[model samples]
Target: MLLFSRFAPNVLLSAAVALSVILAAVMLGLAMDQRWLGLKLEAQPRLAIPASFEGLWIDAIEHDSPAAEQPGAGIPASVASLVSIGGPDQRSIQLTPQDLMEEPDALETYAGMRAFFARQDEIAGILRSIGGVELGVAFLGETQTYSVSPKHQRPVTSLPPSFWMQIGVGLAGFWLGAWIWSLRRGEWATRFLLLAGAGLMISAFPAAVYSTRELALPGRLFSVLSTFNHIGALTFGVGMIGLFLVYPRRLVSPNWLAFPAVILGAWQVVDILQLADGPGLGFHLAVVLAMLAIVVLVAIQFKVTRGHPRDRAALAWLGLAVVVGAGAFVATVIAPNVLGIGAFVSQGEAFLFFLLVYVGVALGVARYRLFQLDEWAFRILFYVVGVLLLLVLDAILIVTIVDERAPAFALSLLIVALAWLPLRDMLARLVLRRAELSRGNLFRQVMDVALTPPGRDQQARWRALLENAFRPLSVTAAADVQDPALIDDGLALAVPGAGGLPGYRLDYADGGRKLFSLRDAELAVELTTMLANALESREAYEKGVAEERERIARDIHDNIGVQLMGALHSRGLARKDMMIRETLTDLRDIINNASNPDLSFDEMLADLRSQISEHLFAAGVKMKWEVESAGPAILPLAAAHTVRSVVREAVQNALKHGQPKSIRVTVRLDEDAIALTVADDGSGFDPSSVQTGNGLANMQARVTSLGGRFNVASGVEGTRIEARFPVDIVRITQ
Candidate 1:
């Protein structure tokens, strides 16, 4: 029941439409058969008065009859001779004057005349052969003339070509009508296809009937059918013209469509009225004009919409349909009349070519998206050119060397293998570069970015890559985002930011020359998802690193720092107490606060001095601090740790190992780097005898890691250590 409700109305309407098409086809067939019917009737036998038949005989005269042998002596030649008639059944007959009075049946009269001729020939032959008796031919003046009439039976096999033509026309109409009915309402192209289909179907009926009119349909039916035939012809031409005008694109006003109907109707009326003396040139002129108009309109459509992928695809298919369908018509129907040669194919077969147009249109109506029609069109173009080249070369080969079709085709194949096949791919690539290649490489690039990670400069890099991909006039973040997926805002694509994704607005794509298609839209969505995934991955990675660093910092401060504090409290000896203090300060600075960068210059210096003084004062060594005009400057966590570690190591080595009398420390800031110098004047020692220890090695490594310079000069005179760190590392504020 549900199915019935959904489909019943359409089924009923389609049935009605099909019935109408069949009726029109039948009518058109009958109409076009009028002339053939007239010729057939005139050829059929009819009775005539014997006076009108005058000197003519009505039967086949026997040559061996005594009357014929004696010529004028036996019987009148006019009475003895007969007339020959040809029709469905061929016959030679004679009629007596009494036949006219009886008004005999044509077939029966012809049969009687035939038997009389045979009997006379038999009697005369017997008499002549016997050589004893003779027979005289008597002259009975025949007042009735008999003509042979055979039963007119038209079997399907023997039906004329026009009958098949009507069938094809009717079938084509149904195909297109069903196609139109299937389409969405209000489609202009649907209307065009229906009009053309209707015209073709309507015109075919009378034509079919006319071709087979020998079956004896009434004469008045022919007159009525003929009138409709002209009307159908005009309608077909108008429909064809209208189709060309509206399809693939609409290039004209709807009002202009009425002109074809009006003009064609006027011409048909003129021809029907027989107002002019010459043949119906006006109807022919109108058709020719419609064809010329079609050519102009097609050119305009191609001109206006060229280079657009969708339009180009539609045009390509439409052109193919025209070439296949129209080419058949011209070759079969038009060329025969124009060149005075037999048709290449029968008109019935020619009608089948018109289905190519319907197929093309069906593809168009389906939107042809699934086919990737742009690439197919390019392939077709290359194929056509290649085939044409092969044909030309083959023709030359046939003329110049190979005179046979087999050899020419073989050589053409070889040429195609060597040249056209390879060249065609290259040509297609050149022509379809933008259509086939642009989006392809872009997706690969997007995938690469997704698989790999773009770092801190990801935004800029992504922008450049996108610019190269789409060749957009501009790409910017949308000020207002409506949808986070992929927004097509007519002029651009707005890909919104989500999670860690950076949003982008691509404006005026392809340098503002072309609009994006559904394929492009889909690609945009994929690319956006890739970009978002890439960004999210980077953000997650950074978040994980930060969390891990914080965890490590807490572990160091809680566990290790407690151990150093305990040691400081337990020890009372100067060196042990100072060692514990320095260790705790180093641990806090290096591990607990290594990732922190908020400390000011004053606080950093104060802590450094306190640690040094505590250690030096315990060792009975003086510590001098010369801190210079260091303003409100600060250091990055890594740089601060490096500086503190280097300075502390230098002072501890001098106080504990070098036994220095005093240590002088000077800190100064330059525009680009901070310079820290520590010098010790103590017991002289030979530097060459001493090998590097872990403390000295560690200080050098720390300074180098911070992208700074570390210098140590040690001799008998004492050691001086200098370290300079770049301002960038510490992020010093003036």
Candidate 2:
């Protein structure tokens, strides 16, 4: 009782300890039985005659006491059934012997069986009350006297295979039943399974003792043991019926479970009192009915539990248990005997069939989690650790003993690297259900999330990365976890905040297929570290760019703006003239693009026309400039800089080389592109024959960098250059 009641807190440890106790009990029973029958005769004297014949023919010449030292009482396989015994001159257990054929009347057909089994108890009582040195034996047509005194004493190893096998059945049932009960102590199904196990042991244990007797046990002890065996059979049926009534789906209230036990107990009473006229009503009827009931209940459970996958799986396992557990016993033992056809094996050996049931159920409950999956997967990880130790041992052995072993280390590592590593990953994915993103892929994604700039959109991108990696069913904001952790038995994983990103709680991993394991937690830690580092690096880069931009703005104020402010004191047109010139120069410097520029295309064109007019007048060259455009008003710094620099260089080239009388600069703007044409009336040279200068190369490079076109044509009339820039393409590059 202490063994059962004290150990519910630690399920696995309790099961192992209780199972060991059951094994020890069975071994002790075997030892006691082997020593109980002290028979050292050369051959066994157990007689198994056909059930049809009934007589005891004991031929004895020396009539004092049976001796192991004398001669052997060679009992043949073919012998008359033993049915009569008496006191020393008083006939006490004599019975009529005949061969009765089967008949249509069921009661008449089994009348001899009923009479023999009913009076067999009384006959055993008579034999048990025998006095010292006195016994009697008789047959139908003859008389003889005999006794069995195994005074030479049996060897310690005198037990038969039937005894060991019977003990196995009992221990198997008892241990497996205790194991299931240990795991699910509060479950009604497991409790009934435990009861079934107790019943199996009760029947098998006592049958192990008397059924393997050398010659005979005392009649009273034999009768009590036989009654105990009947009790086990009765209880076993009741447990099965009650188990099916509630398991997978409860077909009846748990309160109604006692009715089957009460009914079966009453039926056992009738069998014991010989109230039933037919012989099959004793224990076999209960067994057959329980089996039929299990079948019917399984069918009903299948229909009722249609949408429940877990319950259906349990039902399949339990139904298989019934078929394997009780089916063989009926086939070989009870069914044969009830039909007046002799049993194929001894009743003790037939108990082995009952062992199969508990083994199947134990595998279902303990190893498979009712046959769903993912238990051995956890324990096998320890085995993988042991294998790692073995690999380390191999490396150490190679270093110490082998002459040429440097290459062997590589081979060993490669073997595990290619084979064991992948297998381990596959199992981790199957059982642990961690994210399968590769390290390289995850690093790239985390970098993208970090570079998304600081705002709500950046945080959203970070959250999106987590969703893609883990594929959790639901995500919600959570209080900050200092580190990523699995909570609620892996039902939810709490991810820590990294950089500016907030913590999140992820639930029901992989569509609720599995729980998070250490593998998943380790993966989360890796991702957190990566994201933190990437975000820190992006923040540092952006900070450096801002600091540099601040210095440039300061330089503009000190070196350029101060001189222009000094000239602002002049009056009238001169003051305003100086101011406009300072503004045009500052706007060109700003187009160096330290940060994004937001200047309109009209301001850019105004600056360009001013520069052209001033530069042409200084060169003593007449100018003709016109602007015709339709496009977005604001252009980014890069696109505006390209427009400014390209036009400035083209005008300088015509003034230096073309020696033009007059220059015409034409600009046309569209939504996606800007087109410019610079042509001069001068002594033009052949463009193909002349060496290209830095100015022409720079203008062409700027135009083509924005995915536009550049062209040049030269003749005696003048030199013409056309360049076009895709303004939208320039903005996308930024």
Count the clashes in each prediction: 25, 0
Structural similarity to truth (TM-score) of each candidate: 0.43, 0.46
For model 2, the run of ten residues with the poorest summed lDDT: 97-106
Top candidate (lDDT): 2
**On residues 1-734, what C-alpha lDDT tens digit does candidate 1 reach at each position?**
23433654345345535566457545544334321211111111244544334222324323343223442333343334222221322222232332221011111233443343343343223322322222222345433222222212233333556566666665556454444543322555555556666666655565456434432334345445445655665676677677667766677798887777787788877756645432224343454555566567667777876755455556666656655665566556544433434446544466667666665554543333212232444343344446556766887799789989998988898998898888777765554344554556776666555545555455555666667766777788764654533333234666654444466787655785543444455666666776667657767878977965874564355434644665666546754565565666666665546456456777888898887887787678888899875466766566566667678778867865678888999988666677899999865455556666556776777678667888888877788989987767444575
Over 4 Å off in model 2, which ranges? 1-149, 152-156, 371-734
Residues 1-734, candidate 2: write the lDDT tens digits: 45666554344434443554465465445335321213222111244642333443222222222332333452222232334455444645554332111111123224554443445445434444435112333234334444533223333345668777877787668666655565566777777887888788887777876666544444455556656777887778777777888886888886798988888899878766657765476656766666677677778888888876456656777767776678788777777756766667667667877877876675554322452223443344324433554466466668666456666666666766677777766764564433457878888889988888778988898888888777788889876678889885465788886886888998766654444545567788988999999888988998978965764674455435653664575465654675467555755566445655556778778877876787687568998887776544777665776677677667767877879989988888776777889898877776666556456766776678778899988888988889887776423211
lDDT of 1: 0.55
The TM-score that candidate 1 achieves is: 0.43
